[model samples]
Target: MLNSKLLHKKLFLDSGLKTQVKEVNTSNLEWTKNFGDIAPFMQLDLRLIWRNKRTKSSVWMLALGLLYGLFFYPNPTYNNMPFFFIFIGIFSTGIFLINFGQFVPAWDSGYYKLLMSQNIKYEQYLKSKFTLMALSVVILFVLGIPYVYFGWKILLAHFAAAIYNIGINTHVILWGGSFNRKKIDLSQKAAFNYQGTGAVQWLIGIPLLVLPMIIFALFNWLLSFEIACLVLTVMGVVGIVFHQKLMRFITGKYLESKYKMIDAFNQDN
Candidate 1:
């Protein structure tokens, strides 16, 4: 009477083998099911983020990022300089990726040890983070569709930026986080808080934000605005295609830096 697959899942849950169950014949199961096992990490991540007064307050930054275009959209000064749109595109869509990602494991500094003790695969842990950031980029891009009112070019820039954020910048931020995991005091006020910031965080912007702008500007100058958008989009698409490889690489880096991160996180505690 019960669907066989659902029955198996029910048994797995009831037997407490949810995370350890394997496919009948294959050496590996589907990635979706494996990721499902670690899905609770995503929920925990969301709770921790909301629990942090400072991180929770970053919603204002997202609000400001969305409205940032008002400054350029209405100003005739920016009309001739369409290149600036790329800056807004990157910032508006990738604000969350940039703000939350650079901290990486540092955000879990409060419980870095306990988290490490858990049975979670490092790849799954990082995947949960990647999913959150990629989702944010999609949401921000959709919300920014209203920017099309300015011009289709504005929309194009935002699309390219969103793709870039989802594909490239998310991995870039995660990889950058591998180095210099700083301790954060989540209880502190969000205003001008420099609690967890370090040189790596500042330098990461060069790739996450500046490099795309430079690439776009060069293509725009050498060819045309549409070509520039296409180039950025292609770069993002390439990154998306190789996301798994990038995640594996970043996961290894996290493993290598795990002890270092724990030691660093313990300094303040």
Candidate 2:
């Protein structure tokens, strides 16, 4: 029996099983080292977004956002209103935030299990997504410079809306992502595609866009347009100041729902 056990051990070593195990452990260690870094994961997410056809559609949306002033500029009805410019800024800069954000981890549903099984940090993953959306806001704002032709106020409204988006709506959408369970296929074209969408996504727009608009409109009616803008700006600044705390809460939500998300993603539908 002792000789038989020795022979089995010899066979295991001779079959290279021990070596293979060591190699796999070494590879896992190296992978953890690389992907564990925020920069690398962020770069990887960006590369995936750029390569995916659905995400690339945001380019057209960005272009349309840049020219949004064209529609309002010619329309005397909306051109003069501060609210119009603010809405434009929110919708324009928020293209990616709305388009890509609603899906959250659902976007990676295909490989989410593999990702979760790895030694990856949830905060790092969520951070990369937040960074991507934040970058989109900046790019959209820059592309919207031509709206200055409408008026400097339009530009100011855009700036204000961009800040509100970065500070407030960005987190809101990410928080909303905690509820996403439907899987999205990146290969699908963006036009009319609503694979991962649900009631949460639809309702999210209310708080992100409508609530602020209502506040601004009420304040504008009660006080002045400038004050309305100031109110929105102050709200955005407050959101920015408390961003870390918000992220912690949002991260906790994600953690709490992580298993549910995994189970949901594993479903056929």
**Pick by TM-score: which candidate is best?**
1
Compute the lDDT of residue 256 as modeled in candidate 1: 96
TM per candidate comes to 0.85, 0.83
Q: Report the Cα lDDT for residue 180, model 2.
A: 89
Best candidate, lDDT: 1
Scored by lDDT, model 1 comes in at 0.85
Model 2, residue pairs in steric clash: none
- After superposition, which runs of candidate 2 have C-alpha atoms over 4 Å from their true positions? 1-36
Per-residue CA lDDT of model 2 for 1-269, tens digit only, reads 99999988777554688788887764342442454456666666665677787767765666776676777766778855777778888888888777777778787888888888996888878877887788889998898887787677888888888888888988999999999888778898888987777888888889888988888788888998778888888888898899889989999999999999989888877
Residue pairs in collision within model 1: none
lDDT of 2 at 86: 80
> Could you tell me how far off, in angstroms, the CA of residue 42 lies in candidate 2 after the best superposition?
1.6
Clashing pairs counted in every model: 0, 0
Worst 10 residues of 2 by lDDT: 26-35
Tens digits of lDDT, candidate 1, 216-247? 99999999999999999999999999999999
